[model samples]
Target: MENRELILSIKDLQISFKTDSGTVSAVRGVNFELHKGETVAIVGESGSGKSVTTKAVMGLLASNAKIEQGSIYYTWNDFHTGEKKEVDLVKLSEEELQKEIRGQKIAMVFQDPMTSLDPTMTIGKQIMEPMIYHYKKSKKEAYEKAVELLQLVGITDAERRMKNYPHQLSGGMRQRIVIAIALSCDPYVLICDEPTTALDVTIQAKILKLIQDIQKKKDLSVIYITHDLGVVAKVADHINVMYAGKIVETGTTEEIFYDPRHPYTWGLLSSMPDLTTNSDELYTIPGTPPNLVKEIKGDAFARRNQYALNIDYRIDPPMFDVKGSDTHKVASWLMHEKAPKVEMPETLKQRIEAMKRGEEV
Candidate 1:
């Protein structure tokens, strides 16, 4: 990990929204890093601040939203000068971000293709728009690049498709077009926020593969914000398990899947569909997420955590280093030597063993 280049680094990011009821704390001191050519996934249920964190990176937060603290530092290589440039995204003005960072350095592929693209514009024009604005390319140059982008994203008959509007294409084709537009500017970092939420199951797998293929080809750093662990299992190199607007566990894919430590992570893993399980009923995490509007004194997930200790109710656990691994970390008192020994669910242990044995689950 130390040998790889860090593409994006976010530290202690806190975001809130002004409302009639009260100030809604959407994100609470979140931190994560994206390395060059790596895929990191933020996994949690709805309202867990997964999308909010990514939106902050894109500087696309709503008018009512407030950035209370933290910085998003992005580092990119200057191809012309062969030098590395670093910028704090939080400190940049909206105009500066639009002109310099957004699209040129970082681009986002949103959840819904139908809503993300302009209904009135042709798909060709939409793809060419960013290239012209950000790269200052001529119309002919942008149009040629747009066609190549469509082909790069696996769209057949690219030239013909360019003339078609978003409504004319199928859901999968529309998503492919959206990806083409994102890649038009040759961004160093790609943020995908529930990118496959609106697609069919088969199409979802294809889109995931396309993104993986493109990431390797472009050597782009990718951040996937989603609630589905199934998706994370397939594409993520690292995983961040979030609960109540905070990351409770972070580790490599192998560490997170085979040796999860946090109770919240255990719940998430157990709740995943296991076809090998004998029981017909599926597992589900008990209790709902805590309200962000209310004050949380102790651990945010303590109420929902089955293995939560007494200390969990009184004090939030700090991120503890997992034994024998530098990359694995969990925010749970169970990691402490003085804490009582607690085992994960028997079913989850069995599932992990089965997976290790090359069984499908």
Candidate 2:
């Protein structure tokens, strides 16, 4: 069984994609660690580099994308010695990564289940695919385990679903199959890249619950990549809030939701689709992210940040400590002595106050 004591650790990672136009920096100096069985949500909007960061961890980056810097370390039980030791995954070659870890140890539940599963392959075959490739399990044994996996993922009538193809199942069922495949090998780390993105609200909730249940039961470290704060609130133990190509703020889920110090996070939480609020006019972080091709001389969110102090325009704020546990940190000019004490949005202030009061918000 996987342990909850802590697992993958990614530090100071930088990644950029080489395009014809020039290099587009997708992930820049990202830092976060995933504890064993800990559900760490990488929350950010589209183009925020959440997926790309995890993709670098998986050794799944495209040929054009170069992982410019940083270390990704993993701790696993040594079968022979039965001792735990940290392995530097970033140093592993492409072949070694694919051969030794990838799915067998650290698996990924990709976004868009339909595209992930082969149209030609049956549900059972798709679920069994990873085992065959990594575990070298025989067809019969793999098939039997595949059925059990389907059943484990809450797929009723597993035998029936096993015979069906991706196009045959509903969106929810397809998603379950994706989870089943990711878990077929009982991987230590599960990187779920927006598994609920394409599903409806009802399905999204169900899938989220299913993953939580599985995590509790199997003790899987999950790196959840999504822009949905609702989903993050539901499952995340620790939250890493990403913006542009960097992590602007990070803390426990409660910290991010209640005491969020970053302007971008404020915009996200305030913009939640609450009925009382004007959902018709969703609050957005104004202006665009910095163009990475060109050098970023200042804080990347300076243009969009309503609370950007003058210093933000010229200086890139390093992550500064905040009024919380050591884990809580934010990169903002306001933390500096020279920066102004801009007030947080009233809605966020109210929300934080409500949280402190233990009132229903």
Candidate 3:
């Protein structure tokens, strides 16, 4: 993996929004890396800063939001000069970002297609708009590319759908169009913020498959912001488990799913329903996330963590390297050598074993 090129690097990203009541700390010291052509998923419950972190990457945060500290370093290869250039996105002005970066280099597919798409515009026009604005393509060229995009997204009758409005398409078709628009400019990085939340179960699976297929076809690096572990399992090459505005765990998908180290990640995996789950009641994480309006002295998840130590209550745990794996890291006191050795729940252990045996779990 060291030989793989780094597409984006985020370090010590802290984002806060100024509300009437007070400042809400949305993303606190979040950090991660996206390598070329890899899929990384940021998973957590609502208000855990999954979407907020991605919004910062896309420069789509609210006007009241302030990026107090951090740097989003993006590296791109100039096709004309064949030179690689790195830019700190945090320093780029809104106009510069709009002109030079957004849509052209980095594109985002929002959660809800209905909200993201304009009902007044035709689907074809919407898909071609970015190409015209960013690529400076003629209307004819943009129209041709739009039709090709619709076909690439598996939409039939691409030429005919160009004249239809957003309301004229089905939910799944609308989402496919949104994806087509995002891919129109051939971006280096693609951000999907809960892209399937509004679709039904079957449609959700199809959308995920579509994204995966397109990523492979275009060799696009992807960042998925989602709370659904099942979706993460299906798409993510790397997994970052976020909790209360901080990343609690970071590892490859196999490590995060099979050998999870953080309590929050354990809770999330346990909550995911599988066919082997025979219990009458579904497992859920106890307690709510901490309020962001107030300052947090210790670990934000300490109160909710059943395996939390006294040290976890006194000081926030730093990201500790997991043994035998340099890539796996967890922010929890339980990872310490002197901490009491605790095992995950028996049910979860059994489920993992069943999954390893190729059973439906």
> In candidate 2, what are the lDDT values of residues 1-361, reduced to their tens digit?
1344658888899999988878998898999888876899998888989999998888998999988888898888777899987888889999999988888899998889988889998888888878899889999999999999888889899988889989988999999998999898889889999999899999999999999999989988888999888788889989999987999999999889878888888888887765443337666677776777878878889888767777888988999888647888999878776666777888678766765676553
Question: Against the correct fold, how does model 2 do in TM-score?
Answer: 0.94
Tens-digit lDDT string for candidate 1 (1-361): 4438998899999999999889999999998899999999999999999999998998999999999999999998789999999988999999999999888889999999998999999999999999899889999999999999999999999999999999899999999998999999999899999999999999999999999999989888999999888899899999999888889999999999999999889899998888888898889989999889998978998888878889999998899999899889998999999999999999999999998998888
lDDT of each: 0.92, 0.86, 0.92
lDDT of candidate 3 at residue 57, scale 0 to 100: 82
Model 1 worst lDDT window (10 residues): 1-10
Better of 1 and 2 by lDDT: 1
Task: Report the backbone clash tally of model 1.
Answer: 0
Candidate 2: segments with Cα more than 4 A from true spot: 1-4, 278-280, 353-361
Query: Residue 5 lDDT in model 1?
Result: 95
